[model samples]
Target: MKFLSSLVVLLLLFSCQPQKNASDYEADLIIYGGTSAAITAAVQAKKMGKTVIIVSPDTHLGGLSSGGLGYTDTGNKSVIGGLAREFYHRVYMHYQTDSAWKWQKKDEYGNKGQGTPAMDGENRTMWIFEPHVAEQVFEGFSKENELEIHRNEWLDRESGVTKENGKITQIKTLSGKTYSGKVFIDATYEGDLLAAAGVSYHVGRESNATYGEKWNGVQVGVFQHKHYFNVNISPYVIADDPASGLLPEISTNPPGENGEGDKRLQAYNYRMALSRHPDNRVPFAKPENYDPARYELLARVYAAGRDDTFEKYDPIPNLKTDTNNHGPFSTDYIGKNYAYPEASYEERKDILQEHIDYQKGLMYYLANDPKVPAEVREEMAQWGLAKDEFTDNGNWPHQIYVREARRMIGAYVMTEHDVLGAKTVPEPVGMGSYSLDSHNAQRFVTAEGFVQNEGDIGVHPENPYSISYGTLVPKKEECTNLIVPVCVSSSHTAFGSIRMEPVFMILGQSAAAAASLAIDQGIPVQELSYADLKVVLDEEKQILTQEK
Candidate 1:
């Protein structure tokens, strides 16, 4: 992910002229964002005999896949096919080799993946791994495809996309470089490129009435996870006194009534890759601007006789884990990032740094602070950041798990009914079976003065259902040539299920296949026949139907 004077390359290509022709850097398909979806899109485009290039803003290749989300959120693996399933099959193959297992023995690791074998013998799939291992697998895929990736090239949000007659002909980067393409895919979690091209997208949650969904908007009463604080714990700065101002992370505003719409977003946390082994552990360092007062709510959680903590330090391979948010005040910095989806690059960077600093400080406080429970502090001291992982970025994950962001309101919107098997979708580009899992979107002080987490729901889909091809393309009139695989067209509730990493890669492959066919037949992606698109997807081994 190291930059190789690519900015200089872009600057020279533009020649400070402030403008360039379409022929400056041309490709048949240009994929934006350096996510894992972007990797598969470029690879699939190459397989379809199209010249592909990745205009990547990230130096790191994989998004959340390589960003310590190693304990993959795979639901009903039978529905997974194409590049998405193949990635896991390759992960299984890697574990079969001695060179792949460095810190743990295969037999010692045993076999434990969500109620199924960690290594599925019949399917040749692996569902658990380390962060570094996943990154290596993605890097191997990039090298095998021999794809061109322009790293650190950010999109110029203002006046970047060049369009003619309702189609995007080319896009310009911030460095003044232009990339012309017949088709473009926006695979970023933020959907920046899609938005820059004048594609209409929706931010925040839509009301249940908007999509007739069961769980779409404000969910103040539903409590699915243990993220809610104990009712006995007060939210004031001075335990029971409202006269003292609100605590550090507590919101003073009222949580809306259930089923109402709001601008809140799910809590974001680093999926820390922690190592328990002494050889690989890097002791959690106190971050700059450390503030013990920042974790006042966390101290209250411990003092309330709540001893059961650390339930979400999910294990991966090699004595490491994909550590995530646990209790009421663990790693999730609640109600902090509502503006990130629409923020400028500089503004977004500031937000991300704030999150990084907050998380880092939390780790330090847990291991060393006197206020944290002695039992929890002792357990926290046993784990530290992996010394071998994320070597360049101070052994921390580079990509924050952006669970949901600017979802495009395209030709068709996938809803909760689509996921729960009530609405039947005819155009199947891919399939998903994950639960409607949404973290607490807001943290507010209740009527009784106790802090409570709201908007956390975890309901499973009734059956494995197909994702519509319509979700990948914008409305025909907006921008016919651009495809969005990651930030799909879906209700916030449905996006909670479809936003998983596997589905992103599946959508990426399908996007490229459809793009290739559109170029061959001289048609817009929206006008491309579902029958024809299905043919290519089937040939590429995409699972279009549920297996018996």
Candidate 2:
């Protein structure tokens, strides 16, 4: 009797404890990352009548779209279709409601510069919106479709993925949860899932010679945007004194040869949601680790006649602005995020906090520091973080703008030729029309001893171009079951245009459609018939080609 009672108690205790290694949760399709791409992919999979799960690394969804990039960088809006268009349409519906406007009246907002009305009632699409509104739209998709979203679940990059015959079978998270799926989509900005699964990827810029392109590598003198120092400014702490050492944020190393390859990545920053509305604004508070001296270079830039601090404070609805990096010294923490793509989770956290601290300190320096010009300071003081946005994150953007990261070296590499409309793509998946825009990769002293930024390139494509479906799938031998959307195979230069949020959402839907078809046909994702894929993509209203 005593033995029997003990056995029953042990069994009860085992049952009560949660299964940490549970692989019981299986889906026909699994989408990773909490980006706009992830949301669209999951929705597309569900619409195709497949069981799908979104294993999201973020507590919040929609990545930069919901974070703070509300002022869309849409080069050509005509090509945006499918779920991507639906997302903007929902934004239109939200703004149509009179209750959506709180701090500003709808009629008072003048929509300009987008070549069309921001609120396009004819097409039922609104291109510009608030960060919170974007989040709400993404959340609505999840709620309406009854999608299974596992939030804050990070992929254990090391020893987490289980493979069989070069195909991913299961993935485990650091939180000890395992997920099994027939087809997987890596929709992260960082490409963590694809990298962890042993897919070939490239970081940093490749040489122009390697890709046979004009803008693939280092562009020492290229200054399309006003991010480079035009006036002669000494890089030393003391003007014209070499022994005085380099100023803060200026690199000491050489800027590298023109067209040469280097491991330097373009800058990244938070797309701030700030408002001038007094009742709805939170004053820019100095971070706990604030150091005003860190922005000495910026003060010097102001003294040297650079006064475009507020130029890129692009406005969104409700009197808010989706502020981005503008001039020579601004929000972009250039050359600081080189190691972020491959860094360990703990290291990445430290890097993330550093960015948060740097950006927060920048705001404080601009708004309150005595070194800033009086007029500029006064204008900056009027702009504060919107109280209604990112309420949980101290009124700051929750996601950092990871401009570029680990790009896959997959089946087809999209190059400058393709983006420039010089070469037509095969097996078209989606379209991209934005300019090839890359932020400064480094800040270094020029041969003439003046400080200048290098690697900022902005060359507009001749026209809207189609993206290859081959860009989304790995080589058949590497991983047959996985698909990558956000980090599609592309040269660094071409990725600049394809990296836009609308393009990402477009690719996401196409990737999910492919995943569903591959599962149904019992074939590898790489082997999916393009003709059949095109039929489904057409039915889903995905814009595949640019009709002149």
Candidate 3:
């Protein structure tokens, strides 16, 4: 009788305690990353009558779109199609209302540089906007389509992502919750999901020799911007001083046998939220472990009458500026983030905090440091965190603009020739037109002892060009079931142009559509015919080609 009671109690306790290893949820498609691409994918899946869920590590929905990249870098707006176009259209709708501009009137805002408005009665694309408004638009999409979202869910990449016969079976989160899906899309900027799934990817720049391409690796002789102004003034203690212990930020290695590539990666920084509203603004706080010597070069630059240093603090909608790192020794924490692409989560968190500290410290140095020019300090003091934005995280941006990361080694790689109109892709799904722009990846002193920044390209595409569908798919042997819309296969130069938020959203929708079709046809994603894919894309109003 005692044994019988004990067994019964154990069985009842197990039943009521929740199934230990059972999956609590299932979806037709599971997308990792809460980027603009991830949201678009979820919405597209819903439109296709398939169940989908977005599991994002970020608490916010849209990545950089809602982060602080309010000034859009769209190359050719006409080529943007499908849900990507719809997102911008929704932005237009939001601004169409008289109440949209609570702080400023429409005429007062004026059409500064966003080109002529769209003629179809929609307020032409307001490429620039406040971060909160963009977030509302993404949230609106989720509400309208009833998207299932689990924010702040980081994927366990190693043993967490399970596969069977080249298809993803389930993905486990760091919190021990498991999500099962029929198909998966890695809509993350870092390509964490794809990497965890054992997909082949490349980090850093591929040498020009490897791809037979013009611009791939360390470009030494190219001086594009005034970033390295007066490179003669060394950051070290003594002029031409290798003995003064290498300038604080300058790399020590030879700049890699000129066209030969190394594992160096581009700098990453937060798109800080700043406001002129005195009531809501918090002055830039001096970071802990602050060192004044690190900014000595900047002080010298300003003292040399470099008054145009503040020119790149470009204004956005809410009386805030999307201040980016310009000039040498600016906001970019040069040479501190080489391992970010593949670092563990805890390590990434440390990297992010370090970047935050660096940027904040830079702002503080500019605004309050006695060494800064009075005029520059006063101007810098006028800006602070916007009172009405990013309320949950103390008014700082939640997402760091990860400009470049892992580029998948997939079936097709988009190259500069494709973007420059020198070549055309047959399996077109989307298009991009942003200038071939790459931020300085490394800072080094020339043999003549002049400071120089390499890997900054700003060439405009010959015209708008098609983005091939093949760029989004992995090889069949690697992962037949996965599609990477965010970190698609592309040359480092080509990705610079394709890395815009709108383009990512457009690609996300197209990838989801392909995934749905593949599931319906019982075929691998790579095996889906372009004819069938094109038909669906057309029916859904995805702009695939330029007329004329």
Q: How much is 127 displaced in model 2, in angstroms? A: 0.6
After superposing candidate 2 on the true structure, give the runs of residues whose Cα lies further than 4 Å from its correct spot.
1-23
Candidate 1 or 2, higher TM-score? 2
- lDDT (10s digit) by residue, model 2, range 1-548: 99999999999999999875455578999898999999999999999899999999999999999999998988899999999999999999999999999999989997743667788988999999999999999999999999999999999999889999999999989988888999999999999999999999999999999889899788988889888888888888898998989888989889888898889999999999999999999999979989888898998999988888998998898899999998888899989999999999999999999999999999999999888999999998789999999999999899999999999999999999999988979999999999999999999898898898988999998789999999999999999999999999999999999999999999999999999999999999999999999999999999999776
List TM-score per model, in order.
0.95, 0.96, 0.93
Per-residue lDDT of candidate 3, residues 94-208 (tens digit): 8788887665666666444334432224435567677888899999999999999998898997688999999888999988889888889999999998899988888888888
Clashes of each: 0, 0, 3
Give the alpha carbon lDDT tens digit for every residue of 305-348 in model 1. 78766777787878888898887887888888889999999999
Q: lDDT at 98 for candidate 1?
A: 92
RMSD of 2: 3.7
Q: Between which residue pairs do clashes occur in model 3?
A: 75-433, 75-434, 275-384
In model 3, which regions exceed 4 Å deviation?
A: 1-23, 114-123
Measured with C-alpha atoms, the lDDT of residue 260 in candidate 1 is 78
The weakest ten consecutive residues by lDDT in model 1 span 15-24
- Model 1 whole-model lDDT (C-alpha atoms): 0.88
Which consecutive 10 residues in model 3 have the weakest lDDT in total? 111-120
